[model samples]
Target: MAASALISPAIHAVRSASAIVCKEVIDSHVLRIDGYSRLKHMMHGKYIRSGDFHAGGHAWRLLYYPNGSQLQFQDHIAVYLQLASRDPNDEQVLARPRFSLLDQLGNPALPHDCGMHRFSY
Candidate 1:
């Protein structure tokens, strides 16, 4: 799993023209399961979550569902990205997340990509 964000300054109307600079921060975390077959035998809708990790100054985690998150998709697997940080001001965080299932040789077994997402309380 990989997460990235562009932390840009808030734009404002100025009487004088000026140049604004912005930077991007990228971070990633990988969760490897040694006994995936055993996990798949667990009850449906059950999930295992990764530990909290930081990306772009925010805490995040990943949820892995071996037997799928719901009964309708029990034959498949599911993964979700969750925001683990709470803001006192209830602000929203923007991030782009990408998930992939890697094979034993460290290659992508499936393609899972997502667009920009807004995360809040």
Candidate 2:
């Protein structure tokens, strides 16, 4: 019967979503995403957060071609993965994926801002 009563549910939902948000940036060029991370990326749009990511000891690089000219990209790196919490009892897990970069003597610019790089798919 009152305005306060009608608006109670909306306020509750905002609070709920706020409580679940998480983010962290441990290093200058690395990020650690948590279990609650979600992100929507745009080239020149407002940053939609990616909940949590792991970027420790991780580096970025570039790719080149024979005739020269950097490998252009519309989407720098876009991937989606759903992972569960690790189990103490579960052993023999594989190592995290690796990233590499190389420098070019001439032709083709590098991506990822590395001095030089080699990228593999």
Question: Compared to the true structure, candidate 1 yields what TM-score?
Answer: 0.75
- The TM-score values for the models, in the order shown, are 0.75, 0.17
Error of 1 at 12 (Å): 24
**Candidate 2 on 1-121: residue-level lDDT in tens?**
6556355444444343336653533333223333312322212322223344334323322221122222353234332221223435443323233233333443333333222222222
Q: Candidate 1 on 18-58: residue-level lDDT in tens? A: 78886767777788877888889864678999899888888
Regions of candidate 2 where Cα sits further than 4 Å from its true position? 1-72, 92-121
By TM-score, the best candidate is 1
The best candidate in terms of lDDT: 1
Q: Give all candidates' CA lDDT scores.
A: 0.84, 0.31
* 15: Cα error in model 1, Å: 9.4
Q: Candidate 2 has what TM-score? A: 0.17
